[model samples]
Target: MSPLLRYPTVDELATRAAALVTRRPRDARLERVGTSRAGNPLLLLSVGHGSRHALVVAGPHANEPVGGGTVLRLAERALADPALTENADATLNLLLCLDPDGLRRNEGWLHGPYTLGRHFRHFFRPGFLEQPEWLPDGADAVTLPETRALLDLQDELRPLLQCSLHGVDVGGGFVELTHDLPGLPQRVAHTARRLGVPLELGPYDTLYWPSLGPAVYRIPPPRRGDLAAAITEAAVESTWFHPYRHGTVTAVVEAPMWGVRAVQDGSPCADPTAVLRTVSGTLRRDTQLLERISARIRPHVAAAPDAERLLAPVDDYLLVCPGLADTWDPDTDDGPHPLPPLGSAHLAALRISGRRLALRTAGLLHQLVTAAGSDPADALPELDRLLDAWCADYLDGCGARWIPVARQVEYQSRVVLDALALTARRADSLSGEPDWGSQAAVPMHRE
Candidate 1:
């Protein structure tokens, strides 16, 4: 296997975007789209002019660096092969990085080896108010300027397709769509298999959303809400509002960062109840860790408003845990499967891995607080030791390993192209235009 790869630093990423702009001024314009709470300018790179538009937003979360490469690939591809974007009728309105501040904070891991240890050590994700993608729109919500910028762009563009490219720290590769299109599932699955990547046939982030087939899915209705939405009336990314408002086909791509074969192994589990217990146990332990750390650092977090912002995930997770679906009951059948298409045991273990990854932000905050001299009693070392063990368990127990940067980007690019083609074909058919032969059709494979 190829060794894990590092992504360009934030400065290098900006230079690359600038290069793309200079390469095809007629086709591309890199402009400031919005501003982060930290006053960083959020940029949007627009390339090509096609019949329909596909808006690709990346870097919604701090650690998921794969999308930056994917966006660059698609933009350069459009500049090089005009027909590629034309055939898909996609103008390629791309948000290179929505969270520049977050990206800079994650630069330690971003421009280094994408290992689990490095990630947890340098982890940093903002609270609901700080996250642009999940910023709330309701009266009580404090909407970040970046969130407003995205909503404004959506209104102005009214895009035909929107893709928020993301990466998962573990488990299988999967895609979620706001509107299901014919043939997408097969395409996504075939692409994953082509790369020797496991499809997320088991439960993961989009647990409540209905799957179309295999790893492809139609995102849950906007009314259903999410972890952020639970805290705010209108969580930006969770509801997937583009589909309903603009008639856009919104998609979220999760390329796995680590893998265990069992993530895709579908078989009848010898015991279903045991799997559920294991899942519940992990959740219980994670929640307990969050509680201990948050309680220990609550005063410091309150004293230092910045610390409060850092502890948002821990706070929000605790706030919403009672309603969160991490607790699965065997008799309830509240998961993808009790057996087959991923046996209960394997899928349940996946739940453990996801929780571990999610709670890492809390652990990171613990480290931050202790390092800052907030804990007079040095409450963090004992907790940090336990956290170290959990991280080890995640890496060793789940068979965590690097998913090369190139492979991850390629998988995302393939899926986005396939989706663009499907949407473009639909546009042609809906227009009642006479078939322009090959132009009217999008081949599943490259010519």
Candidate 2:
């Protein structure tokens, strides 16, 4: 168990961030930027004295926390290396954790030994709307309290770049860009390759989106059929989509909580439809199982304090996603090439997505059932064991292993550092000044 693999608690992160500013008081200061929906303070640490500003946010999704560690460590880097900060020439505005209310719920397993078993035992992911930094579908008029804090800062400062650090349950590393800056995709590929993290060649969530490069996808201006899946999600707007001032180009970095070798297997499948059948089967089975659980607990759901919020994910899974899966046909895609034949990796990624969705549904539903307490509460322990067994079997079948939090942090921070250098170079080029070159100028920051 490496210390890097152990995620810091929200309080501990705030304490350590404060200490960083205290030690380098002249260059850094910590302030409460805003409050969470649950009343937890959102701490933003401002580091360095650069003309431009770069906003780095982490923990936008409660379960994906590689960015939280990256934010803390990157703050330290900004304080210690003057040239690194001078080149990017931007103040590092670090939001240590964007969704503290949701993250606090996942702290049970964040403390260490990041095994699938422990994760299944302590897993908790709030519904899309309940997780911060999202606006409900067709309700762009609203902003989450946590997201409002970021928007307020973004509007006032208009930073040069914004980074949303995220991680996956299990898959390869990938990057999403709001703006297609030159040389960034190369930097991401090099970083993941050097760190032994496989790049995500498999596309599921990124499906139908344009690729900026290998494993790198452009987020906005959704490609054809993108919103078909978007409509199923309650809050589809993440942090990156909110920034506009200074044309704050955003980059979302994602790494896997556990590394799965299959994500990189892009070889052809003998019978691709067979893989789709497996995916369709898994989705229906998982949905039916959860529906049974819901039927048992329905009598008490209305009494729960957070019933509406907790039920959103279950409703989406039971009503929307499974319906699509049931009628989905490989022939539905009238593209130049067939859909399912995209290969084994694509199929594997689809299965991984389904399994993750099931886990999310089960995690949130159990919370709702427990809070609404009745005889259904007694059924939770057995339900948990069933999920645990499912997870254990899937982990083995997929050949997945725990990924150290350190590698994930390193990949994300290095990408930010290089992006800073590259963006600066582009700015200099426009001003008729010589290119500052890449991170090769700064030995300490190269991947």
Candidate 3:
């Protein structure tokens, strides 16, 4: 068994964080922000008694819990050494897990024996509109308890620095920053290399955004009446950095669960247009398949008590994805635009989409089975066969290659710690304060 498989559950992580704060009562304080939709306590661990503060948020997406481990390690480090933040008069505010309801849905594969097959089997990610961090309109429409809690915290703390930890399905890690801090991208790249994580250089789903380095990118602010805005209205990143008036330098670290050499190869392609056409075609097929499956199960699911809530997002996604595919223009540019090389990252992205669709389909089907009061054996055999076949195909297409969980945590923690150190050093330099020895150095790996 790999050491990466040895990760703590949400309950265990919360208990551990509470214990750390309890042990270092003088330097730390623990507070419950609010309860999740599922009634899990959302915990915040505040370390150091400094005037300036940095907010670290983890586990916003249920599928990407690597941030949870990273936050725990960071809180522990801050508690052990007060000089890490006290020297700069800064406090470390850690949110252990934001979307506990989603986290609980994914807890099936989080404990041990982490495999790609098992991971996707229990995977559940709410649609973008359904997520707690971002919604279609301003969070003013936000009904989720978790989102409300986060908004309240942002209003109260108004941190100087905010770090949202996120992970990818496969390929290399990347950094997204709100502000162009000097030397930060380089430091992030260096840290990733030292931790033996690849930096994805190929065209990702968000390739339209300009890149600062191999994998580092500057997140563009959402424009009104645009797709980005429509998709991420009042997102946490934009809210914290733009209108919040806190001068918060927000950073998002997206690390991967697996890596391959092809993710970094940016070689010119023979025919970029053909590649775009192929991708567009795949999307069209997937959209059609989802529509067919939804239609088949709709009558059954409609009678369930929570029918609309369970099916609306999936329907919206199905509608939007096909429309996006229809709008793809492969010949927009006169000059050659190289196709993004197909790599492990590409495969991983496809696999993730397939798994999500399957999960949604299964949910609808399960509702149908229950509403009809049919025997388990009498449920739709055709739907079951199709789902089983899709899962097998997804696994077969993307070969098994897992990155150790410890390495993933190390990369995330180092980037976060380095950001803190850099922010503190900038403050010290401005104030003409002497640098604190050793505490100012950013370690390649956490001690």
TM-score for each prediction? 0.86, 0.89, 0.82
Candidate 3 runs further than 4 Å off: 1-4, 139-141, 202-205, 226-229, 232-244, 303-309, 327-400, 425-439, 443-447
In order, what is each prediction's RMSD in angstroms?
Answer: 4.0, 3.4, 4.4
lDDT of 2 by residue, 192-306 (tens): 7788787777657676567787788777642223443554432256556666536777777787778887887878889877777777677778778888887777776778876
Q: Candidate 2: RMSD over Cα atoms?
A: 3.4
Q: Least lDDT summed over 10 consecutive residues: which range in candidate 1?
A: 434-443
TM-score order of candidates, best first?
2, 1, 3
Candidate 1, residues 179-239: lDDT per residue as tens digits? 7778888888788878877777665465555669887867655553555444533324442
Candidate number with greatest lDDT: 2
The Cα local distance difference test for each model comes to: 0.68, 0.72, 0.66
In candidate 3, the residue pairs with backbone N, CA or C atoms under 3 Å apart (3 or more residues apart, or in different chains) clash, namely none
Error of 2 at 230 (Å): 2.8
lDDT of candidate 2 at residue 160, scale 0 to 100: 73
Clashes found in each candidate (C-alpha, N, C closer than 3 A): 1, 0, 0
In candidate 2, which residue pairs get closer than 3 Å at backbone N, Cα or C atoms, i.e. clash?
A: none
TM-score of decoy 1:
0.86
